[model samples]
Target: MRADARKNREHLLAVAGAAIGEQGVDVSLRDIARRADVGLATLLRHFPTREALLDALLRTSFDGMAVRAAGLEASGEPGEALVSWLRDCVVWTTEYRGVTVLMAAAIEDPGSALHASCVTLRAAGARLLVRAQAAGVARGDIDGADLFALVAALAWLGDQPSLAPRADRLFGVVASAILTGAGGGDVEGAPPSGRG
Candidate 1:
């Protein structure tokens, strides 16, 4: 593709990504083309089908998460990095609510790009989970599959804006309790104050 054509394609992907990632898979490509200031033909040339476009959008999000996870694995302490990764996952799910639905659909329908992304995500998440377990900072029995399910549940909070922030807080509280093997922050029901 020519330089200008490639630029237009990239622009279209960005616009389509935000729209579909937010609105859902049902978003119209014509609107995406208009948002990107490109013609219909150019959009179709880049993504032949609506499924292909949704797959690309999901792949883009997954690829970004993979990169961030890789970076966390590289430089951060194992337990700390795992916590950071969990926090980031909640934030990402909140931003792209449609992703949870897309992931579920992909799991039922094989040969999907979203399925490939899920595989990669599982591998990456497993690595971090193993590291956290080794450090005795996470549940040893927590598998990657379970974590994926939790993330999907977390995404459901996005449907209700009033609950999203509270959900993140509750997730953090529960995750910390699981990591520390504590219950409701002791009998007094107050979180222990520390430099953790």
Candidate 2:
């Protein structure tokens, strides 16, 4: 890309990220363009569709989480690795209010721009769950889909004004339910403060 074109794309991404963080997945593209001080046509040229823009926004986060999960998987006991990664996933998902809904939909739609990244993220979580299950530390009944759903469900709680305060506790409850012998907040490699 040309220097000026790359600059425009970066600026648009920054503006769109802030807008989506505040207004969620449904934020208007026109508003994003306005915030970036560009015409909507320029925005469209950069991101042909809303899903394309969202894909650009969320792909890095999805990849980062996958890398984090890999690090957690290699750093500790299986159960702790799974639980710690789960906590991080839920917290990250909660940061973007409505992205989980799109993630869920994208997971089932191969043609969607975000589908590949979402699938990779889910696979990363699934690997952690599989490792834990193999170690007999996590329940055998639940699979990767269940684990991913738990993340979406927990994140949805964070989006709710009424239930937001309880999200952290609820995450603990869910995380504990997944593990055979570990407390969610007390996982071996988890942060001491236990934000989730």
Lowest summed lDDT across 10 adjacent residues in model 1 is found at 187-196
Task: Indicate the residue-level lDDT of 15 in model 2.
Answer: 94
lDDT of 2 by residue, 1-196 (tens): 9999898998999999889888888999999999999899999999999999999988889999999999988889898788888888887887776999999999999999999999999999999999988888898999988898988998888888788777777777787788885423443332222122
Minimum summed lDDT over a 10-residue window in model 2 is located at 187-196
TM-score top scorer: 2
Residue 182 in candidate 2, Cα distance off native in Å: 5.6
Question: Candidate 1: lDDT of 4?
Answer: 88
User: lDDT for every model?
Assistant: 0.68, 0.85
lDDT of 1: 0.68
The local lDDT score (0 to 100) that residue 112 gets in candidate 1 is 76
lDDT of 1 at 179: 63
lDDT of 1 by residue, 167-196 (tens): 645666656654644212321222221111
- Which residue pairs does candidate 1 place in steric collision? none
Model 2, stretches more than 4 Å misplaced? 182-196
